[model samples]
Target: MNIKFSGVLVGMVAVFAATSASASPRPDAGHYEWRAGTQAPGPRAPLAVARRVWVPAAIAMTDADVCQSMMTAKSGAMACCASHSS
Candidate 1:
């Protein structure tokens, strides 16, 4: 009985490991290629670069604007400032 239970447990573990490994995304499955001198199709590369730069700047500007607006208002200043303090 103990041997049978151990075998079943080991089988279950093997099945789970196989399924998890197969479910993961393959490294080469995306549009971008990592080989030297092989640029991703035009515009996509630049667009990705721009996004990396612009998104953080835009978020910071938005947070500053919100904080400024909240300070100007008499009520809810504490709550707004507290939330944005982070």
Candidate 2:
């Protein structure tokens, strides 16, 4: 395509985009803003750490390949992934 044609195409897209944006409402226009912080936070419990969680050290790309590798490596998350993937 010639430069003139490409320029016209870009100009048309810009025009449409500008019109659409002007017609659309502002993102935060209808939302409520929360400002209340009068109440104090309750007591927090100490975090517990797992000693023997089987998280995989090696990373793989595909879901099936990851499952297989993790299964071989005995990762606990792979067992959980079986439920989610199904």
Candidate 3:
């Protein structure tokens, strides 16, 4: 009787999952309005790490190429310059 009860429970769970999957919410349709006068938001810049992380802050220098190299060294391959800025 335990085996039979387990089989019924499994069947019920399967049916419930299938029904829930079918009843999933649909994506939003085009019903919103955009105001003409409002200005669009400016592009966001990527997160900046402190210069000290890339190089010693007390070096008393400001060099773009050196900074880029230091950034790449600290962050490895994940480090990249902004394409728009270049």
The residue-by-residue lDDT of candidate 1 on 20-79, one tens digit each, is: 988977633434323343345776474232211111122223476665765434443444
Candidate 1 pairs with clashing backbones = none
Q: Please name the candidate that would achieve the greatest lDDT relative to the true structure.
A: 2
Rank by lDDT (best first): 2, 1, 3
Query: What is the per-residue lDDT of model 2 for residues 1-86, given as tens digits with 9 covering 90 to 100?
Result: 69999999999999999999888755434444344334454556334423443333443345766666654324434553535442
Pick the winner on lDDT between candidates 2 and 3. 2
Error at 74, model 1, angstroms? 65
The true-structure Cα RMSD of candidate 1 reads: 11.8
lDDT of 3 by residue, 1-86 (tens): 99999999999999999999888664232233433333445567334322321222232344567556644434354234343132
lDDT of prediction 3: 0.52
- For all predicted structures, in order, the TM-scores are 0.32, 0.31, 0.31
Model 3 lDDT at residue 50? 26
Where does candidate 1 have its weakest 10-residue lDDT segment? 50-59
